[model samples]
Target: MYDLIIIGAGASGLISAIVASSSGEKVLLIEKMSQAGRKLRITGKGRCNLTNTLPLKEFLKHCGSEPRFLYPAFNLFFSKELINFFEQLGLKTVEERGGRIFPQSGKAQDVFLALINEIEDSSCQVLKDTQVTSLMIENNRIVGVKAQSRTKGNKEYLAKKVILAAGGESYPLTGSQGDGIRLAKAAGHNIIPTLPSLVGLKLKDYNQERIHPSIVGFGVRNVKATISLESGKKIAEEFGELTFRENGVEGPIIITLSRQIARLLSQGERLFLNIDFKTALSEQELDEKLLSELNIRGKEDLRSVLRAFLPHELIYLAIYQTALDPRKKASFVTSQERKEILAFLKHCQFEIIGDFGYEQAIVTQGGVDLKEINPKTLESKLIKGLHFAGEVMDLDADTGGFNLQIAFSTGYLAAQNAEKED
Candidate 1:
């Protein structure tokens, strides 16, 4: 029998094994995939944003469901400890914009290898291609786990403790297929139904005017995006480059707000995105410049005058939407026509009908409810010697390095507390 049986060889499971086995505790890590860290290898487009360098309070705000649930874990093994752990393991790291940390070599595979190497060096046994079917429990206490191996058939292994770090429902190909939630439910843990977050929103295709082949890849810089309910209540707003897809919106800002609107949009509340193309100028200031330009350049075609403010494809829509003739000389343009153009630039809008779903979502927004787990130790309040970490524990955060750090910190704490019982 082993001292710890950690399920899933992703970020959390690997860290848990590394920490627990450091004292030479007998640890077994099980993974369904042949390779460890399948998902971790592809994070941050392979650069792997390992952790955010945000101060504790600021960093916690990026999380959802409950940010405070991670306070105890962070207090024990915050970002500094995490970075130091990797640095000691021989993976040199560097920090980028917004305090995001990554490997200096800029390869996620390198970071993944360093963790695997640490696990190997710790003498922890790793069982690859072994899928955990269920947690073995007796009298609401941890026993071990049953598994099905591709090469070795059915088997049951008993351990003094079990740490489930199987992750959430996002990136199914990476082995996060919601198995953790099912395992938690079977063990009597309440699960908050999962939803897609940090994903692109697909707008209604009714008018079909918002997107066309020419506009599909268009990107605007330094724009302010505002989300409002159909009832005209402001929800959230972000400012950055917004990229338009044939389906809808994406980019740093759009993905960041996706989490806030996912629930409301799914509930059938009509939500709209209002973009300000000229954030640098007040509406009055922009209008005055437009009027002055029209007065000075009125002899030119309206399409030509519009070139001073917009791209050709965007002006094409402006021409169609406002019923303004492209061939009309600026001098002949009506004041009402100018107002329409001004409104379109300052308040371009689209309806957010749906998201790209889990297939494209960066992370799942829900999992085992945090209330059932002990915050300090990450142990289950219902089951002795049972622990949780990472995306499987109803903890997710905005895109940055916050989520990865949560996984590392919780994993470290779970293993420490799990073995401390021994």
Candidate 2:
């Protein structure tokens, strides 16, 4: 029997195998896919954002909920350890904007290859096309896993200790099909409500023909996006790029707000988002600036004048929403019309009706709740020798390498702790 059996060879499983094998323990990494790291090859548009170079406290802040649960993992294998781990595997990393770390070669495949090479060098057995069907339990302890080979058809194998790094239900194409959650539930583990995270929101507006041609591929950067409830209470706010798509917004800012929006929508709450287009400018400052521009370029067409302050498509749409004519000159514009334009710019609001589903989500928000797992070992409090890591555990962070760091940290910790028991 092997010392450790890691289910799923995604980021966490791969790292766990590497760490456990390094401890001189025989490790078997099982992957249902033909190759390891199917999802890793597509991360960060194939560049593979490995980790964020931010300070520890700042990095923890990006983790929305249960950031404290990561204290032990982060202390053991933080961003610095992750960078060192890859460097030792001969995969050099470079930091980009916002301290996002990527391979110097700028290929996600290279990152995956390095991890595979490390596993190989550690004498770890890679069992590809091996789908784990269920956990093998004995006396309330996870003794092994029952897995079947996809090619061999129904042939099963058992292992000594199982680590469930099977990831959450995000990209089903990548083999994250909620099998781990199913296995965990059967083993009497509590799973949190799974929901889509880091996904794009779908708007309620039906004027797609009008909005699509105008704002597709358009992105607003360094702006504040505020989500408001039906009672006009601010739910969430973020500052980053909000990319406009034919479907809806799908950028850093939009993705960060998506989880909260999805939860609200699921609860039958009518949600609205307001973008502070010019967040850097105060209301009085913007008014003064607009009045100054008007004084210098007096009596020009209202549309032409406003075009300098907003996107042409947004200007036209705002004008339409305000019931103002774009052809009207500044001299013909009423004071109320100017006020409407300013208000719309500062608080351009839209109703969020739904999300784009799991395919577009970067990560799943909820999974096996962290409360049921020992934070230090990533082992379930309810089961002995059954460890959880990565997206499968109810831990997610905003974009910018925080999530990847968590994956590596928890995987490393789980492997180390599992090896200690061995």
TM-score of each: 0.95, 0.93
RMSD of each: 1.8, 2.2
Best by lDDT: 1
* Model 2: per-residue Cα lDDT over 158-250, one tens digit each: 566789999988989999988988888989888887888888888777254664377777787888999999899999999888887786677
Across residues 1-422, which tens digit of lDDT does each residue of candidate 1 receive?
99999999999999999999998899999999988999999999999999999999899888886888888999999989989999999999999999999999999999999999888888799999999999999998999999999799999999999999999999889999999899999999999878888998887642335433566667888999999988878999999987777677788889999998887877789999888888999999999999998999979999888999988867765665566788999998898989988988898777889988888888998899999999999999999999998999888899899889989999999999987888
> Local distance difference test, per candidate?
0.89, 0.85
Candidate 2 wrongly placed segments (more than 4 Å): 260-262, 288-300
TM-score of 2: 0.93
Worst 10 residues of 2 by lDDT: 203-212
